[model samples]
Target: MILAVVGGKGGVGKSTVAFGVAAELDAVCVDADLGMADLPERRGPDLHDVLAGRAAAVEAVDESGPVDLLPCGRTLAGARASDPRALRAALSAVEAEYGRVVVDCPAGLGRDSGAALAAADACLLVTTAERAAVADALRTRELARALDAGLVGVVVDFAEETGPLRGRFGAPATALPESEAVRRATRHGLPVGEVAPESVVAERLEEVAALVQRSTRSV
Candidate 1:
């Protein structure tokens, strides 16, 4: 299955959640944010190369990381050269080889974000408690529905009040409190599970992952 981790607004810890869920699912996480790749930077043929037709999608996956990742190029030139429309095929190829893929989509309602949603079998929305963030997430949810990607779950970052979100999103909502361990793990491009397995943040991530798994199965 291909799961797209999407947040309409940036800086909501979407990439961190994507990486953590990928780690829990033992799936390859694809940094589909071509313009602003947030996951780890690795040395090899990245998503940019794959989308630019310079490399095979499977060949660009970096397995040396804590979690397998298909990193994206950081250069603006590379991003420009990449075809957003090719993302679906590339993701499909990766899923074929790896069995599962978690895509960290770029923020907003742009073509890049749309492409990721279009390619995904289902999506998990990530947002914050702020009204603006929730509004944007609502817009994202509409986009995902339009693209035919089932909304499996929602992750509310740095917030403990999940009951309202569950009703608003009509999906299971998991709260991820702000944590130094998560911050430190993200700074090093490692999943919280790897950085602090015994921490509360890690336990919450596991819950988020389980919610996604069950939701997707029903889908």
Candidate 2:
């Protein structure tokens, strides 16, 4: 299954969550965050190279899971616009190579993000407590529906809030605080389950993995 994690806002921790779930399941993360390939900085071969045919998918795989990665190969000096046809071919190669492909899509509703979602079987929508972020998420969902992709989860990360006050948002507006732990892990190039084993983020990632497993089984 190709599970893509995406958000309207940049800071919502989509890649971090991607890392977490893929790490837990021992699955590949196809880092489609092309505009800013953070996965390579933390862990990878820069998928841009793979897409460009400069490298093989196996060569780009991060081995974080037993999991491989197809890092964004497009470069800092690369074209501003992505070649959708090329990306599609690359993703087809990736999908054939891995058991699970978790794509960390670039934020917002744009061609790059659209290309990533178009390749994915489903997506995990990441959101925040902020209203604008939620609106973006909703739009993202609408886009996903239009693309006929399944939505697996809605991750609500709250890295900013603290203490008991943070608990308020947990029940209604969010899924719990995956934000804080994920932030630390992503910054350090570690998966949340690895960086903070007991964190809510880690536990949530486990749940997400199980859900993915179930979905794949059904398929």
Candidate 3:
């Protein structure tokens, strides 16, 4: 399975949902969020090398014992509009070697997100309860739908201040509480679920992961 996790805005925990879902589904996670890649917070081969023909996608992967993270390293200027063919081929190579490919797409309806989604088998829309964020997600859904991308679902992050609002699209949207565990783990260069497995946010993310996996199977 190849899934792109994207939204039209940033800081809505898009990486959290991307990595969280990969952990739950036991899939290979790629940090396509190159501009602001998070998997590299712990250090890994830079994606810049891969894009520059200096490295293979697998060479940039970090095998952290439980799962492998394909982190994007080294910041680049024109990476946002990079050709989808290269990214697709890179990811396809990894898919042949792993169980699944979970792409951590950049925020917004830009070339980076579009290229990643264009190469994905499906997409997982990440958003929060904010009215503005919801609108952005809807526009993202439209773009994904236009490209004929199979949508997994919408993950509503930071539900501590949210309602029971479903996604603008018809897909299911589940909310998780915004907890300190998430903040602490991210700041310390660790996966939130691994750092505080029993925390409220982590538990909720696990459920969200399960939902994503189930949706994948249905496809």
Residue 23, candidate 2: Cα error in Å is: 0.9
lDDT of 2 by residue, 22-130 (tens): 8877777777776777664435445666655566666666665433656665566543444554766676666677666777888999888888788888778887778
lDDT of 3 by residue, 111-156 (tens): 7778888888789888887889988988898889887778777778
Per-residue error for 185 in candidate 3, Å, reads 1.6
TM-score order of candidates, best first?
1, 3, 2
Report lDDT (CA) for all predictions.
0.93, 0.70, 0.76
TM-score of each: 0.97, 0.83, 0.89
Off by over 4 Å in 3: 42-44, 77-84, 161-164
Which whole-number lDDT from 0 to 100 does residue 173 have in model 2?
26
Indicate the residue-level lDDT of 42 in model 2: 31
Give the Cα-based TM-score of candidate 3 against the true structure.
Answer: 0.89
Clashes of 3: 2
RMSD of 3: 2.4
When 1 and 2 are scored with lDDT, the better candidate is 1
